[model samples]
Target: MNEVFARGPSLLTRLCIVLMLSVGAMVIDTKVDNLSTLRTYLTSLVSPLQYIADLPGGLLDWSASRFNSRQKMLEENSRLTNQITLMNEKLQRFVVLEDENNNLRELLDAPVREGMYRMIAELMAVDNNPYSHQIVINKGAIHGVYEGQPVLDDTGVVGQIVEVGTTNSRVLLISDITHAIPVRISRNNIRMIASGSGSLNELSLNHVVHSGDIQEGDLLISSGLGNIFPAGYPVATIINIVRDESLPFASITAKPSAQLDRIKYLLLLWPPDIAPVDALSPSDELTREGS
Candidate 1:
């Protein structure tokens, strides 16, 4: 115990001796490569110990990198998701605009009468009742829309206005069960009444004799007998004609010329002498009415 407590050399003396030995070794290593073989052996012996000592620090570095990479990936995924959502919304808007542009172009290209005044109107709502095929327009009495006014699309006649309001009007489609239009066959000028079959694509010519000259694929035009629709406008095309000796009238079915189910924009027309003197052009009139 007494030898252990008694120091062999003073602190300053030991430190000075250690520094002298380190300097001597460094000088010998620089002068000659005498320590090379010794160093190689020492490194071989200490390599595993060095690796063991640095293991915790290497593990910590690897863990930090993995966590940071995961965080970056999550942020990138969220950013890409938001960008895709915005792109889809823009694409939908572009599609709607394209459809509206196409419909307007077709309406502009439709043939018009010499003395008739025309304006464009947009559909606001459709009647919910399944029994009635009616649609409401944005124009009404305030826009000079009146009851019994003729309505048409780019292709042909659509319907007539049944009720008028201050800013809206109800139109009875020609496909309604109660609707009928006077039609004349373009082939033989045989006049008949084309009644709605309660189907958007069908019209019936009731009370036709078996000896009628009507045939399939014949074009039917307005006969101008009702004074509501003008003459020469295409109404329907005969698609089926059944001649039966057992019935009084042959069963006749025709397809409407206008696309009633897909109507988006319509043409409201004022016949000759009915249009106002200051009536605006179709484009200007639609803009004014919409505003």
Candidate 2:
């Protein structure tokens, strides 16, 4: 037994000492209400070598709380920003609609007789043809716009839709070499064909005899002779006229009533009914012959 004691401690003796200490601590704690409060003093006195016992648990709880708080704040900020952006966009659209309605009301109240209705179309692209005054619009069959439909602006006739697609249409302006309008001299009611001279600002009055009564600065209005355009819309104003006695006809030039240089937006005239123009286009002959 003395030899066993000399070698530090036998295994049984160590186990018995640990069991006794646990029993003592439990008994003292159950008998005293302040045993838990006194545990820190007892631990420091009994074991002065433990320094990092509670550090891992404290660090884990602190990091978890910080992570949750940061995540919640980021989500709240994103939701608020999206809401503000949507509200601002809606407000801007409302303002634009109000302004457009007011302008239409004023035009209706004007003294001019307006048989033409308007459909707003945005100018999508401009063609680079110097010899032809033409542009494209961002509207087509999907928007109820079609080929041969007359287009106009606030002042006068812009052109007609020459090509149409599902979502876009091409406009041939009045100054194109192939475009023409049936107009009459405002002075004497004489009718003539105003043909485009392939210039941006000038159109020529062809087939007017040397003795015609049209003078410089005379206004030309659509006569509704052709079913293509509605009548009484201002088409052009004669800028210059030269009738040489030796020539068979007058050499006349007129500026388009519709501005041809720049068009950001324009209006399309909607006919009461889009009756088939089978008589206008030869391709419709197939339908007629088949029937």
Candidate 3:
């Protein structure tokens, strides 16, 4: 190594000499205004080399942009497909509404209910209890659904409002064991008490007269006995009446007028003013207190 060093300068001394010369040139270019033209010429000469150095990065960025666009297009297509499916479902529901309106108009002229107000509400949920037949409606006291207000549907009377919430209400159906509504024969207006039997589609008549002028297939409508439900709204139909000479009252069973198993929407009676007549009527109060 000493013989090599003696022959000439070492490799490290040669690198340091080259570095010192490059730094001295940079300092001279920056300090001397007369060499500005030389610096500009050098910059222009190396511009194309700088462009060559940046080419690979630009190409990679363009490929990445194209890949992102393909992914965005796929996501946009999926969103459009879901929106179209939802619109089609809404269109089919409109058709059902049109048919139901036509039927209601026909019955309007058949000497049915008059001067009655109704609002459409969706059935939000049904209670999971065997003892109580309660349902949740999307309408509430905010929408004029007061406590004890009558609830019905196109087929028949379903229940009455028991609990009114801010935006929803709970209804106790006539099938509940605790619910009772005053009813009577539409043929002769013989008043009686209709009690829930805990069955989905049945109500039992309490203290029905042996000759109450009711027969199988007879439509038992809301006779406005308590005046809570509007008069002439179908409540049930006489299905069976078992007479027992040994017992005081006959065993009566009636099928509900409404489609209890398949009810999706309901009509909430929203009158201008609700009167709690059933709660205050002498006969109804007496029956309740007695029970």
Candidate 4:
């Protein structure tokens, strides 16, 4: 017992002394307010550890943003490329249309006989019949388009209006088998009749002799005798000529000067000699047919 109690003070006395020291330190900190600087120093010391803990998450967010930006740029680039390609195709078509417009303007500037007038119309539809080459134009009775009105392209005569509506009209191409036009030889003014052969590129001449002045490569133009088409318009070019002594007439074939299958725009002509009263009213005919 004596050895166990040999320490400087008993356990109870040592505990009381430690409590007193702790209370004295608390009082000094509260009354003097001297520990705030020490707390700031401690927080500064811990800041690097806090940053290290957050670094992984920050790096992950940055990487994801970078990837998304690259993907968006690629998509934008592809869209731009497609737009450029479409624009280029349209530009090519515009160039071709510009050239055609210039040629038609030249035709418009040419002097015509008194009281002759012209208007431009766009092709609205083409006939599906293989044997009949016909087209529809965007002009009708409302626009003064009447049956038998002459139609022309940039190069030459195209056809005549056969049926007219309020806003659209149908044309009977010169290449139709039932169609015929009076033409004359440009070299000698030798009059002949040109009939369509149900072929887009061929027209036949009627009652031509083997010894006639016409030959291959002769240019045929409208003679103005038919009272339909205007005079001096290019019609066709003679392509072939055959003669047989036993036959009364020579076989002659010519190609039309106008590109009927390729034209997109045409001119509707009004001739002075073709009195408006004499021309059939398309609206009246359509009404009769409908009835």
Best by TM-score: 1
Find the 10 residues in a row with the least total lDDT in model 2. 282-291
Indicate the residue-level lDDT of 132 in model 4: 79
* Global lDDT of model 4: 0.76
Runs in model 2 with CA error above 4 Å?
Answer: 1-114, 275-291
**Strongest candidate by lDDT:** 1
Q: List candidate 3 segments past 4 Å from native.
A: 1-114, 273-291
Q: Candidate 2: TM-score?
A: 0.55
lDDT of 4 by residue, 1-291 (tens): 878779588789999999999999788878876687887898999999999999999999999999999999997765554344333322422423443465558799776445345555778999998877789888888777889988877667788999999999999999999999999887677899999898887889999988999878887888788789866777899999989899999999999988876877676777645434433232222111110
Report, for every candidate in turn, its global Cα lDDT versus the true structure.
0.78, 0.71, 0.71, 0.76
- Spell out the clash pairs found in candidate 3: none
- Quote the lDDT for 72 in model 2: 94
lDDT of residue 175 for candidate 2: 85
Instruction: Please provide, for model 2 over 1-291, each residue's C-alpha lDDT reduced to its tens digit, 9 standing for 90 to 100.
Output: 878758977789999999999999889889998877788788877674454666678789899999999999987665554334333322422433443455558788666423333445668888887766679898777777777898775456778999999989999998899999898765556899988888878899998998777788887777667777776667789999888989888899999877777675566765545523311121222112100
Could you give me the TM-score of model 3 versus the true structure?
Answer: 0.55
lDDT of 1 by residue, 228-251 (tens): 876666678899988888988899
TM-score of each: 0.58, 0.55, 0.55, 0.56
Worst-scoring 10-residue span by lDDT in model 4? 282-291
Cα lDDT over the full model 2: 0.71
TM-score of 1: 0.58
Model 4: how far residue 206 lies from native, Å: 1.1
Each prediction's RMSD to truth = 15.3, 15.9, 15.5, 18.0
Query: What TM-score would candidate 4 get against the native?
Result: 0.56
